[model samples]
Structures are given as C-alpha cells and as structure tokens.
Target: MALIPVDAALERVLEGINPLPAEEIPLHDGMGRVLASPLHALRTQPPFNASAMDGYAVRASDTLDERRDLSVIGEAAAGARFPGSMGQGQAVRIFTGAPVPDGADAVLIQENAESVSDRTIRAAKPVEHGRHIRQAGMDFHAGDLLLEQGRRLDPGALTLAASSGHARLLVHRRPRVAVLATGNELVNPGETTGQDSIVASNSYGIAAIAKEEGAEIIDLGIASDNDQHLSSLFAKARDTAADILVTLGGASVGKHDLVRGALAEAGMELSFWKVAMRPGKPLISGRMGAMHVLGLPGNPVSSLVCAELFLRPLVAHMQGARHEPDMRSAALGAPLRANDERQDYIRAVVRHTAEGMIATPFTRQDSSQLTAYATANCLIIRKPHAPAANTGDDCRILMLHR
Candidate 1:
C-alpha cells in the first residue's frame, strides 16, 4: 500500500467514530467530563428578590432624602423571609442573600445609615431604587439554557449547574483504553536488567497521556514476541471491553516485530499502516469488533510522538470533546535542509522573543533520543518535499506544553 499522508492517516484513524454513550453522574464527579445534553436551569437562581449586601431594606421613596428616619419593622436573614410587608417610613434589617422584604424597593447600606434607636435608623445618604438588591432570576431563570451539549464541565460550569439546582449531570462516559507493551528484550522498570535487556518505559508514558485525555487506562503489562503470549494479551484487552487497544512496540516489519501479525491473527481489520511521517512511519491502526487498535513504534520518542498526534485526539473524541491541536506560527531559530517524502516533526525548544515565538530544532533528531523529546516544548512541522530554509524563516509548530 502507498504511504498515507499525515492528514489522511489522521482522518482514517477517526473515520466513522462517534462519542460513547452518555452516563448520569453526580455533580461532584462531573468536572472535566463533556456534557452529553444541554443543561437547563431547574430552578431560578435568587428565586426571590434578595439582598446583595448587609443593609436595611427600605422603600426607595422612604430613603430618598439626604436625612430620613424609618422604623425598623423586621429582620430578614438568609433562608428566612420577613412575613410582614413594609409600611411607609418602614425598613427591614437584611443580611446578604436574604430575601428583600415585601414592599421594599431598595437596600440602604448600613455604612450610609446610623442607628437612631433599637427600632429606628436614619439614612445618612439618598438611596436609589434597586440598589444593593439582586432581583429575582437575576442570574438565571428556570428552564433557561445554561450549558450547551458537548461543553466540558470545568469548575465554573459545575458551580453554575449546582446553583441552578442540578444535583446530577449527564456526561459522556470516560473512554477506557487498554495499553500493551510487546518486546522480549524489555523488562519492567525497577527490575534487574540483563546486559541485553532494556526497561519497558513506553507504556507508562502512553498510560499518562490516556489519563490526561480523560481515558481510563488498563495496563496489560509486557508481552513477549511469542504469538501465544501476544494472543493472551489481546484476549485480556478484549475481556476488559476497552475502547482502544494501544500496543507500544512491534509495529515495524522486522522479524521480531510481531504486533501487527498478532493483531491480524486476533481479527483486527487493518485500516492503514506506514504513514508518510518520519519517526512514526510504521504506525498501525485497525479494529476488531468495537475495539480499535493502534500499534506504535518501539522507540521512545517515536511512540510519544505518535501518541500525541493520534491517541490524545481519539480519547477526547470518544468523550464527546472538541479536540484541536495547538498549532502555532513561529520564526525558525536555526537553518534547515530540504525534506524528503516523509513529513518531519522536529523536536524543538520554543521561546518567546521580542520579535515573536522562535522555534529552535534540536541538533540530533534520532528516533531513540527520549531526553531531547522530554526537553523540547514544541514540534516544528516540516511538510513533505519542502525546500531548504534559512534562520528567521516562517514556520509552523505544534506546541507540546503550555
């Protein structure tokens, strides 16, 4: 098969995909979850005219003069309303969030009033109508549309929903991803390693990405190159009912690279393989039943790059989120050479300069260099077959960090 372009490969990876079913969860657990349906206010906020400050609720006409004395008729505290209505030259001592007493059109702040006696107070300054009062439904009215579908419930959103009388919210279920690492030459971290063995580090990074993108992860540990062992791991993924199965290594066509063959044997209908992208060219994607499978390269940098480009978006999409890569324009901080057919994502350090953002690509871009990838804050994108450029030329980059 011909090498698929980067954009085309991403399109194929997301084709026919839809968000998972919605689930109702408590408001406390709704943060970062996407709304599955529009949120309508169940009850009006400030259901009644209420005080916005600790003051005396009086008729605007009663306190219009520079100096006026009014009888203190009643007191209204939060959650308690004064039963009697105010008469002419009458006022009610009110606290913040307290309901405005009947027949009171304004609140005279205590700062501008002086207590004349236990039952009377003198307004030292004129008061305007509706001053220091929150009108009924000021924040939101019952049945008003507060949050739209697909909105992520951040802190503010959760507070709004709660104040609108919502104890529960309908949100998209978190996507469950199963991660499997394959390599006979790999051993778990913290384990004593032989001279020829290296630690399996890719799965932990992949799992972190999945978690940050709102996916619950099931780590399937390590699977050797043996077909039976790979098959057992695939069975575990199926049993977990994972939305996506991510294989950390064994994607290339090498003799020991058995991930693709094992997934095929496990009944994955291959979508596409070998994208036209450097460092991640051997990426593999397919599906078996409802579970999607992605085979990433063994190299640490390549595995992480592929995960950033593909896995994050997939998980966000499954959660009914609107995911877009943070692509930005920058000036080249160094000279570059012409590119080949495969597109290049050069790891770079991005800094804000007086001119603009400057992206300086690392000197060595070997796929196995994890330290450089960890230190870089951005990926400078070079299109396939692009011409050479000098320092200070315009370029596009994908920001990896804030």
Candidate 2:
C-alpha cells in the first residue's frame, strides 16, 4: 500500500466513528464526562420568593415612614415560612434564604433597622419593593435548558447540574480501551533482563495518554511473538467488550513481526499500514469485530508521538467531542535542514521571548530517545519536501502541553 500522509491517516482513523452509547450516572460522578443530551432544570431555583439576607420582611410602603415602629409578628428561617401574612405596621423577622411572607414585598436589612422596643422595630432606611429578595425562578425555571448536548461536566457544570435538581446525569460512556504490548525481546519492568532484552515501557505511557483522554484502560500485560499467546489476549479484549484494542509494536512487515498475521487471521480488516511521517510510519489502523485496532510502533518516543496524534483524538471523538490540537506559530531558534518525502515531527522546546515565541529543536531526534520526547513541550511540524529553514523562520508547532 502507498504511504498515507499524516492528515489523511488521521482522517481515515476517525472515519465512520460515532459517540459511544450514553449511560445514566450519578451527578457527582459526572466530572469530565460529556452530556449525552440537553440538560433541563427539573425544578425552579428558589422555588418561592425568599429572603436574600438577615432582615425583616415588610410592606415596602410601611418602611418609607421613619416615625412608625412596625410590630414583629413572627420569625421565619430557612426551610420555614411565616404562616400568617403581615398587615400594615407589621413585619416578619426573616433570615437568609427564608421565604418572604405573604403581603410583604421588601426586606429591611438588619443594618437598616433598629429595635425601638420588644417585638417592635423601626426601619432606619427605606427599602424598595423587591429589594433583598430572590424572586421565584430568578436563577432558573423548571424545564429551562441548563446545559447543551456534548458539554463536558467540569466543577462548575457539575454544581450547576446539581443546583438544577439533577441527582443523576445522562453522559456518554467513557470509552474502554484494552492495551496489549507484543514482542519477544521485551520483559516486564524491574524483571531480570538478558543482553538483548528491554523493559516493556510503551504500555504504561499509552495507558496514561488514554486515561487522560477519558478512556478506561485495561492492561493486557505483554504478549510474546507466538500466535497462541497473542490470540489469548485478543480473546480477552473481545470478552471484556473493549471499544478499542491498542496493540504496541509488531506492525511492520519484518520477518519477526507476527501481530499483523495473527490479527489478520483473527479477522481484523486493515485500514492502512504505513504513514508518511517520521518516527511513526509503521502505524496499523484496523478493526477487529467490534473493537478498533491501532498498531503503534515499539520505539518509546514514536509510540507516544503517535498516541498524541492519533489516540487522543480518537478518544475525544468517541465521546462526542471535537479534538482540536493546540497549534501555534513560533520562530525557529536555529537553522534546520530538510527536504524529505516523509513529514517530520521534530520535538522542540518552546519559550516566550521578547522577540516572540522561539522553538529550539533538540539535536538528536532518534525514535528510541524517550528522554528528548519527554523534555520537549512542542512538536515543530515540517511538511514533506520542505526546503531548509534558516534561523528565525516562522514555523507552525503543535503544543503537547497547554
């Protein structure tokens, strides 16, 4: 197959993808979950006219006269209302959030009133009608649209939903991803290693990226090059009902690359094999039964770069969200040589300077150098067949960190 460009490959990876089914979960558990539908207020806020401050609920006309001392008929506190209405020359001692009594349209704040005698007080200052009162449904009314569909529940959103009388929320199900690492030369971390054996570190990074993108990760451990071992893990992924199965490494056509063969035999339809991008060209995009398959390169840096470009967007798309990477322009801090058919994602450190944003790429960009990838905060994108760029040339960059 011809090598697909990065943009084309990403488009193919996301084509035909729809949001996962919605599930009803408790409101408190909705943080970071996308709402599946428009959220409506179940009940009106401040269902009745309530006092906003500690004061006396009285007729507005009665407080206009400074000479008159109104008799305090009764007291009203939160969760309690004065049963009797206040007539002329009468006031109800009302606390904050207490319901305003009948025949009362204003609250004379305690600071604006003074006790003339027992059970009697005088308004020191006049209060207008509806002053210091929260009218019914002022904040929101029942059946009012509180949140739109596809809104992510943040702290503010969650609180707003709760205050709107929603004990449970309908949210898109968090995508469950099963991650499997495959290779014969790989060993579990902290285990005994031979001269040629390396630690299996890609799965942890993949899992972290997946989780940060709102996915539930299932670690399938490490799969050897053998077909039966790989098949068992694939079966586990199917049995677990994972929405996406991410296989690390064994995607290339090399002699020892066995994942593709086993997955093909197990009925995974291939979408694409290679992308025209540096470090992450041997990417496998496919589907097996009900699960999406992404075969990432084994090199740590390449694996993470691919995850950032592909996995994050896929996860967001599955949650009914639009994934737009943070792309910005920066001046090159040093000269760069180019002219290659494959697109390059040169890791670099971006700094804000008096001149402007400056991006200085690391010297060595080997696929196996995870340290450089970890240290860099941005990826300077170089288009295919681009010419050499001099220092201070404005270039586009994808920010890895906000």
Candidate 3:
C-alpha cells in the first residue's frame, strides 16, 4: 500500500477530536487543568472605593488654592474606616487599600506632603479628583466573564479565580490512556535479556509523553505475540475505561505483528496506516467506540517520533488544548543527503549561531537507536523527493523543548 502524506495523516487523526465532558473540581486540584466552562466573577473587586496611597485623602477642591493646608479630621488604615465625611480644608489620613472617606476625592502621596503636626499636613502638589483612588469593581465586576472555556489554569488564573470569589472550578477531567507493548522478542527493561530478545522500552517513553500531556496512564505490561494475550489485553484496556489505547510495536506486516488485527477483531474502525514519514511509515491509527487506538512502530526512535508527531496532540486535544508540534525554521550546519518518497525527521543537535539557528544531524540515522533520539534536541524535517541540502540551507526544525 502507498504511504499517506504527513499532513493528510494528521488531519485524519485530529478530525473531530475534542475534549470530553467537564466536571466540577476543588480549586486546590485545578492547577494545570483546562477549564470546561466559563468562569464568572461572583462579586465586585475592591468592593468599595478605596485608597491607593499611604497619605491623605482630601477633597480635590480643598487643595485648589496655592497655599492650601488641611487639618486631618480622622485616620483610616487598612481594615479601618473613617466615619466622618471630609469638607474643604479637611483631610483624612488614609493608608493604602483603606476605603476612601465619603467626601475625599483624591490622595496626596506622603512624598508630596509635609507633616505640619499630628492632625495637619501641607500639600506640596495640587490634588486631582479620582487620583490614587481605586473605584469599586476596577479589576472585575460581578457577572463578568473572568476566564473563557478551554483556558488552561496557571498561577495567575488561580489568583484571579480566587479574587473573583471562586473557591472551585469546573474543569475537564484528565483523560486516561492505556499503554500496551506487543511483541514476542520484547522483555521488561528490568529483566535480563536473552541473545535474541530486547527490553521493551518504547512503552515507557510513550507513557511519559501521555502523562506530560495531562493524561493518566494505565500500563498493560508487555504482551507477547499470541492471539489470546492480545485479546485479553484489549479487554483489560476497555475495563480500565481508558480514553486512548497505545500499542507499541507489531503494527507492520511481520507475522508476529498482530496489533492491527487484534484491534480490528475487537471492533476497532481502522482510520489509516502507513504514513509517508521516514522511520514511522508503519504507524496506524483507529477508533474503538469512543476510545482512540494508536499503533506505533517497533523501532524505538520511530515510536517516539510517532508519539511526538501524533500521540501528543491526540492526548492534548482530548483535554481541549491547542496542540501542535514545536516546529521552527533553521539553517543547516552541514550538507544533508536527499530524502526518499517519505518525509524524513532527521535527528539533530540545534545550536545558536552568530548568523541564526543551525541544526546538524547525528552521524547515524538508524531507527533503533534510542540514544541518538535522546541526544537530539531537534528534528530537521526533509520533504519527500527533496534534493540534498548544503551548509546554510534553510529548513524547518521541530524543537524538542519550547
């Protein structure tokens, strides 16, 4: 079968992907969660007109004259209120955040005043009405939308919600992913490997990626190439109520590659397979009822690349995040060879240069090398049928870190 282009494959996988239903959660547990409903201000901010300076609050007209000096009628500190109203030539010593006196219209900062006595002060500058005064609901008003749906909660959001009188938030529940690694020759990393068997490592990396995208993981330990074992694992995945199922390896034509078949037997509607991407051509995606199933290639590097290119977005979108690969343009540090019919994601090291960004590919481009993938900070994307590139050639690179 001919391989599908990268964009088309991505479009297929992302079509109709949206966050699940929302749920109400306590404020303490809402950090890093996506909002499912709009957050509204329940009360006005700075509930009353307040002072913004630790000085005197006086009627603006009281200081209109050139040599206006005023007597302090009363004092108002934070958490204290001045009872009497102020008239011309009368002032209130008010601290920051204290409610402004009824007749006071402005504040003369301490730096702009000279204390004549315990109950009097001389103004060094003219005061303006509403100056240094915070009006009621200045930050937010009751019934105003404070945060929209799909907004990710950060520290600032938390503070805003708290100030807006919200003790809890309605947020999307974190999706759960069931990760299963399939193959007869794969063993657990902690177990001693035989001459012909290798440790199953792709699931660990993919699991971490899913969790980082805010999805909880249910690792369905390594399953050998057996029909019964594969069937049982799928059943367990369903029982765990996973929102997504990721199967590592056994997604290709090999006799022992039974992931696709097992999923189809379990009623999965195959979406697509064989994307036109080097090292990850055999990747497959499908859906079983409401659950998404992703078939990742057997090669460690291929599995990771597929996860970044595909799985990350699926999981992020499931939680209503605008997810996309972190791609940026860069200049080549060295000459690169031509690409085949598939788009090549060449593992590379990115560096800052006097001219601009530069990416140099690793010496070996083997699909099985996990060390190279780990060492690479970027992937130089080469389009299908693209010719060789020379030093300083412009190219698009996917940054591993933001």
lDDT of 3 by residue, 104-130 (tens): 899988888878888888888887989
Consecutive 10-residue window with the lowest summed lDDT within model 3: 60-69
Q: What TM-score number comes out for model 3?
A: 0.91
Which runs in model 1 stand beyond 4 Å of their true positions?
none
Model with the higher TM-score, candidate 2 or 3: 3
Off by over 4 Å in 2: 63-68, 328-339, 350-360, 385-395
lDDT scores of the candidates, listed in order:
0.93, 0.93, 0.89
- Those runs of model 3 whose alpha carbons end farther than 4 Å from true positions after fitting are 64-66
Question: What's the CA error at residue 239 for candidate 2, in Å?
Answer: 3.0
Task: Give the Å error, residue 175, model 1.
Answer: 1.8
Clashes of each: 0, 0, 0
Per-residue error (Å), model 3, residue 331? 2.3
Q: What count of clashes does model 3 give?
A: 0
Candidate 1 vs candidate 3: which has greater TM-score? 1
User: TM-score of every model?
Assistant: 0.94, 0.87, 0.91
**Colliding pairs, model 3:** none
Tell me each candidate's RMSD, in Å, in order: 1.9, 2.9, 2.3
